[model samples]
Target chain A: MTGLKKTILGISDMKNLFQSLNNNYSIDLSNYALSSLKSRVEDFMFNYHFSSIDELIHKVESDASFFQLLLNKVLVETTEMFRDPEFWNFLKINILTRNNYQNELKIWIPECNSGEELYTLQIIIHQLNLQHKIKVCLTTLSPLNIERITKANLEIKKMEINCANFERYQEEGNLEEYFTNKANSFKLNPEIIENAEIISHNLFSDKIPGIFDLIIFRNKMLYYNPSLKIDALKILNTGLKPGGYIAIGIKESLDFPGWDQEFTVISESERIFKKIIRKEE
Target chain B: MSYKYIIIGGSAGSFQTVTNILASLPQDFSMPIFLCLHRLKHVRAGFVEALSIKSNLKVIEPNDKEYIRQHKVYLAPANYHMYFELGNYIGLSTEQAVNHSRPSIDISFASAAYTYKSKLIGIILSGANKDGAYGLSQIKENGGLTIVQDPEECQVKTMTSAAISATNVDHVLKANDIIQLLLKLQNKHF
Candidate 1:
């Protein structure tokens, strides 16, 4: 066979593999941007020593656990603690401290993969001595993510950027105060995570347990297709209380048509929005 | 060949070059230009401001899910990898940094190569790392036009050289020459 023909055949087989995964798992990956998904699936295949997509599918069909592992690879990306630290400062001054002075603030961090964002929030709340005044629920798609978060396998190297971010916040005291250093990874002090609960929740389908004063749906929306993004935004709008705030990734925004009717942009630079019209119960 | 999008990737010493190219483009240049440059995550925001100050074309860091528009330059925001969406929109990802860099050039270029296919023009400018090489190669493989800044003229030649070695690059021009080529393309078919 010609090299061009071989390449074409290989591409078709790979596409078929992803199609099969989507069909069998009932997870809609058709909406995912193809290049990143293809690259990720290639990485997954390489890691498992499967030269062909068919081999990988056979393994997936045979073992339930392998399928979960593949989902984890394709769905979640590695996240950092205190990513965009200024946003945290904005949250503290503008959203968190201002409202709910009398009651415990309910913050739901949906798509909280591996708990970095939630842990960052927890640490800041601790720093502000607001642990008693806040209840945080962190959720991911799989139990494996929850376990990883619980284990807190934070690489020691990331401390540099995390520390730099903390320094930018101009917070008093050392960043090390929040974490207990282990051999390779630093685990956040149990006290910091004590007020937080981690569980499995699919952002696309699962019903949120309760409304939140601050719903952090950061970075996760960037992965969704147009229809899925609209649906996810609707779900987030539902999860937020009236006048509640939502902070997305700094690069992200609430810019779709009629999005302004649901939420008002409080800080465009910081990507913070306040719920104006609450979703009907 | 005509192109729908012009994508450029650089790191290290390439920011100045990017701004120079942006400054040179005509106000009515019709292609949607996308830039992926390596930057620190915690640097908050300043890139768009810096580029906007020098460039004639409207320059802004695109919001995730924002629709793409012509005659505008969209920069990959710090700490996120940006890509093209199917419905003529921009998408961002918090995926693991490739080549130890977020806003990874490879991911952006590959996605553009896939989305725009032959209707993509990818350029690699001056940089110290090989981050953009694989992506440029992907663009070439997908039948898109790939250009690399002449390593001799680059402040740091590593990245451009890497790109040159990775693929049969369509053009090896200095930043000034690249601007000329862009203007020609803009006038010819755009």
Candidate 2:
């Protein structure tokens, strides 16, 4: 009984700490999932050797520089190249190679965390030899992530899955062809990085780029609240050109209200939707 | 202490045991249930339907960022890891599969333990893998209640035995006793 009460009290204390941080920093973290946020914050505290949440909160109030570290930790990127190989195959075969929108391709990767998805897209574009026709824009909210993406070095550990996914997609090129082996990492081809223009833009506050032929915003909605996701979907709708295909993570869906009015499912299994053209009067 | 959520994790040879337990649960069971059973990425359809065929509570395969409600069994959809968002909604992820299972039990259980703390009741059932062991330990560490299916009673004892070895479990109950415990907890609370 005492233990249960203590845990309840501990949760309340942690909530209060977050509330304090919100009030002081003007950073609204209510949109992030509490469990993930809590885990990240706890990890941050542990790394910094803060004995308690109150101590961490006190440090944040005292030092302005600590906020950036906190932000970097909280928004840590989790991505892998060629994740869900079948989806990549579908994009390559159905969208890229198909002659539907063959004039020129403008690809927007919103929330391209640390550039794995961006690099994956680049690899596909390279394979198709469509580099000249394709203009890629990758956007993220975190400057730290933008810097990491700019580095273009992927951890060597990800090679196993990346290789497996490539083989599953039956992708033509060898994996080693695009990367130079570093001591503990693999540096991506500089030409591919040059192809992408990485920008720092907040999904909530900043304006997205102009109409894109395809916008990939995979696995990002899971971090948001349901209402926030609805708003984000509405905003993302404006960033797409008519007939533009938008691919979300396979587990995600466009089931929000009025989603059907704007887009239709192009591939239900892969969760790709194409924007419908509504004639402007 | 009262629990706000019931979390169950299983792998091989668990479907029948889970269905049996779900069948015994009453319609008015108010605690939200999160289920993570290991399944292949390509096995995407009909899992919720199969589970709902025997369940009294609403059985659903939760979508990304969906608001969670009580008296509902939210099953982790294939190829996505399920986590609690803001302690009130379900968050689905396509981040690389852990333990070669997309809807990894450890990921969901760890997420649930962080959010609910002592207000969670975790159950580990029959399986071949040790995926749920670390997660059950996390739940127990957060002062939550944990029940491991008795290894002798499990169809495949590996998962259950691993869970028991990982932490000091509150109860080691077979399917029938587990069903009874859930009913008793329900009646005691609501």
Best candidate, lDDT: 2
Clashing pairs in 1: none
Clashing pairs in 2: A34-B86
> How much is A166 displaced in model 1, in angstroms?
1.4
Candidate 1 interface RMSD after superposing interface residues:
1.9
Look at candidate 2 and tell me the lDDT of residue A72: 68
Docking class of 1: medium
Give each candidate's fraction of reference contacts reproduced.
0.72, 0.64
Write down the lDDT that model 1 would get: 0.81
TM-score of each: 0.91, 0.83
Per-residue C-alpha lDDT of model 1 across residues B85-120, encoded as one tens digit per residue: 667788888888889898899889977887788989
**In DockQ terms, which candidate is top?**
1
The RMSD of every model to the true structure, in order and in angstroms, is 3.3, 4.3
- What is the lDDT, from 0 to 100, of the residue A157 in candidate 2? 76
